[model samples]
Target: MSLIYPPLQAPKRLLFGPGPSMVAPRVYQAMTQNVVGHLDPFFFQVADEIRSLLGYAYSTSNQFNLAISGTGSSGMEAAVANFTEPGMKFALLTNGFFGDRLGEMARRQGGEVVRLAKPWGEPYDPQEGREFILRERPQVVAFVQAETSTGMFNQAKPICEAAHEVDALTIADCVTSLGGMPVLVDENGIDIAYSCTQKGLGCPPGLAPMTVSPRALDRLKARKTPVQSWYLDLQLLDTFYTGHKYHHTASATLFYALREGLAMVAEEGRENRWQRHQRNHQAFVAGIEAMGLGMHVQNPAGRLWTLNTPRVPEGVDDAKVRAWLLEKRGIEIAGGFGPLAGKVFRIGLMGHGSTEDNVALILEALADALKA
Candidate 1:
């Protein structure tokens, strides 16, 4: 006889981790809508609307805005693979794990990588970045706007200006910032910006929303060598999204989820949503400090409102605390990694999860766990 297993049933989790934050009920409902063909006219209409909403979310007027049919990492790869050519110089600003990953992607694309290193849990100096860009004169400069690993928020305007000064394209990893904070791609002069459907968008994973400025498109058009990744090639992908051409079998359900999530963002208004994240972050910080815990990001201005990294108490085991919270309270919080492993806990308050009730609940649970 075949072994029997229960039907798929997932518990209700209060997601307080770095990503895949709590999805809104409406978004879940939308995902259950009837599936449609990738090339169906109605699905194409959904794709078009997503492009416009993504433009609003990113605060950009770039014409190349579209959602890649993968996670945020796919967006990262697309940004690097399309812009980087063999022997082309690429300057990467490394202040955390994601920045280092960008540098690695650039290197794999055959670009000569020049990493501008900064300590984790710190932000980069604009002047230093400008000077580095001028000295290196790399063809592309990339940085993470929100460093989720250490909860550091990087300033984009200075970095973009610096890259533009030397005619280098700017690529911003807005994975943890978009929808939760002000990306303002046009105002910041970012040539390319990429984010995911999860996190601040309050949607499921599998969609990477991205936009590319005209300057970056011009450079891509002028490139002598073809882009390496066929699946992520912008030239081919554009035809499918922009024109009535077929590229791949895009998931209609994921698009439905993203569209509903974007609708929620629009309903709340961007500024209001950002302020909500900020307020919750402040409250969380106050609670953490009151419990005698410290934050990983020392500089107030460098702190990411979406992802807060609180230092693990000296005597407590980080894993034990996280496990206890999950088992006893059904709360899902993540521990830090890389240099911050066993040193800090990453608690995210983003999108629908960025609420007063959730903040209070997490803080109470954390305090109890610490005391235990």
Candidate 2:
């Protein structure tokens, strides 16, 4: 029997989950612009604009910055596969799911993995990983600046400082922090940083905005071995983006969306954007506390402004509450992952999605769900 369906449509949802936050109407309109060929000069103009805007979004002056034609995981894998060779020691300071992901990718790249592990919800003190870096002297040191799974924010400065003392390159997972909070790529001395266009950037999921410092670019150039993945090879990709020597069929449609989103970021000003996210986050936290719920990240300073993890109340099924919120309120929030599964809810307040009214709306819906 053939299946029947109504006209294709997406259900209206208020995205309060970990990523792919609510896209602004401006970005949506940009997506509707004429799709140009990747080689078209108009496409290149948009691509060039995206490159410069990525610098501003990431707070970096690095020239080797561009959006990878894949998601955040692609960016993570590229960073690992390009930097580490066989038998090279790779130190991963992991406190959450994304950090562990980096370690696994490095190991697959033949990196000698020594992961400094911690519980899921705990934030990292940059000093805690200093001794590990000092002892290992790994060629590549990687960490997640924003632990998306647990709403914990990790500082990169001291880790970068310690890694530099040993001449080690640093890779920061800025997927959750970029555009929502401060990544401070230049100030923290991060060698390589990667993030998704979703979440903090107030765009849909498609591209991973990545940047490499001059030092990291130099390391990449001097590497004896060919980069494992041809598609993710930054040098070849750079030729396509900068030299306009078509290496792949680039998505000019997504470029339009990103260009407009970054333009919004530029107009808002980076500091103002950070403050806006933080302010909404605080309001959400206060409302949650008033509802008798506690946050998973106990340390207030380390809590992320983009993603918030609220602890599941005693005797409450996190899944049911999430389901109720979705079915009854038309709101979408996320549940915890890995070790913290069933323990917390992941609420994302990112980019244009982070607002006073959203905080109020989600809080009200959450309170009703809990009561139900």
Candidate 3:
């Protein structure tokens, strides 16, 4: 017997999860536009627009900026693999899952990885980080600027200064921070940074927004060995993004979506967008606390405005509450992972999805779900 494949129709959902926050309507509409060849002049214009917007969103003046055709992990691996070589020492500040993953990726690339581990939900202190750096004297120091898993924000300035003082390259994971907060990569002295389009960019997940400072680019230029991951090698990828011809099959449709998304971001204005997210986050916290729920991250200033993790009330099964929210209310909130598993629920207020109404709706549903 032959079976027929069905057409697609996605259910309407209010996404308040760790990633894949709701795509702006404009971005969604752009995805449905006419598809063009990747090499077309118009497509190159789209690429140019995307690079400019990414630089603005990331608050960077770096000449090297591109969106890789993959998720945030792809960007992370690309940054580490291209710049770090075998037998080189690298220090990783691990307080959450993504930080550990970066460390693992660095090790896999044959870099000697040393950890300056901190408790989850706590940002690493710059002085302590410096002490570790001085002890390890690593060639590179990496940390997550926004620890999504634990709802902690690592202030990039001090950490970058400490790394730079010791002559180590600074790599930051802004996967959950970009477009939500001021990254100010050039001002903060970040050598390399990577973000995901799905989180704060109000776009779907396929693209990894990445940028490298002139210093990091210099390292790539001076590398004695080829990058282990040929597909992610920045030297060749630069050729495709620059004057040289295409090196791989680029996604024209997604590029269109990204261009439209960046346009919406420009319309909203970056500073205004950041303030909007902060406002919604404050309101969400107020509503949740008013309902007697506690926040996981102690310092309000250190909490990630885009991704909020609230402590799950006692006797409330996170799985059950999450299921009720999705199946019954059509609202999606994420459960904790790694060290935070079953302890807190991650609620994202990001990009176009960060709104007063959305926050209140999620809180109301959450209160009811908790009572049930």
Candidate 4:
């Protein structure tokens, strides 16, 4: 086979990385269905169903919820760009990589960005975050509800409340939280939140499921300047998804997969699904502890249930272990990055990938890899 066009055969690996997690069989089947035009009536019906289903996934009734055509970062950019304009003061709470990405997006949009920085793998103190928001008094505030790089879950309620108190619109990066845990957009007062299908939603990576509160939407529509990215403009997306107008060629195959994945979420029941992920995470942690390995996050409550980060033992090479799992065991997992590089292993038990058997398999394989 040519190097550029290699053979289609691929090795099967148990995905335990941070994202692009194992997809459900049902979602795969759904993708094999007939393809329809982006503007087809049937496609519109599917789109409508997806938006409605996304409401259940995001735990909101904001009426402006829809999937962005790009990945989770795209949704993050959309959320940042739509509400923030030139000269606006934007406050970012950064504890991990994605939080910094938000600040970058805002800066690119010509917003004045100020940030409160914390060590990676540590969730911010709610009071400290609130104080920063109030002190900065930014027009827009953004934070990561679930930090993918470090497996930390920051509290959205306090952050959202503080933003509102300062009359700032809030954006939450829920890329790793949406399906595996409780986002509680309405209850948490999250004005805007976005997630990826590949992580908690058990679908492939293409769509970014997003929700925007009326407050944020109003601010977006009444912006003094046009949104920076035309492709990610919420107003245009609103017309495309809700108004049935031609904007872009959205993938019906991907939409089919998303709709089916979301339907599975509905069938499994949101609360029930969250419980399942929680149980699997606890079990996995117990197994890791039993193996004399420690977790990356000190506070158990702040750690992510969907994505777990375990401390790498002294004298053991993290990359070698991950390589062994891939070459010898055909299991795919991830190593830590940034300040966490070579110090932790980033393992995911998200969406369809979360299960007792999978947990046991990883533990056994990792133990063997360590022994090897």
Per-model RMSD to reference: 1.0, 1.3, 1.1, 1.5
lDDT of 3 at 134: 81
**Model 4 CA lDDT for position 80:** 88
Candidate 3 displacement at residue 39 in angstroms: 1.2
Please write out the lDDT profile of model 4 over residues 29-112, one tens digit for every residue: 999999999999999999999989999988899888888899988999889888888999999999999998899999998999
Q: Which of the two candidates, 2 or 3, achieves a greater lDDT against the reference?
A: 2
Residue-level lDDT tens digits of model 2 in 137-214? 999999999999999998899999999999999999999999999999999999999999889888899988999999
Per-residue lDDT over 89-171 for candidate 3, one digit per residue giving the tens place of the 0 to 100 score: 98999899999999999989999999999878877777988788888888899999999899888888887888887889999
**Tens-digit lDDT track for model 1 on 290-346?**
988999999877899999999998888999999999999998999989888999999
Q: Candidate 2: list runs displaced more than 4 Å.
A: 1-7
Q: Give residue 281's lDDT in candidate 4 (0 to 100).
A: 96
TM-score of each: 0.98, 0.98, 0.98, 0.98
- What is the C-alpha RMSD, rounded to one decimal, of candidate 4? 1.5
Off by over 4 Å in 4: 1-7
Q: For residue 295, what is the lDDT in candidate 4?
A: 95
Worst 10 residues of 2 by lDDT: 120-129
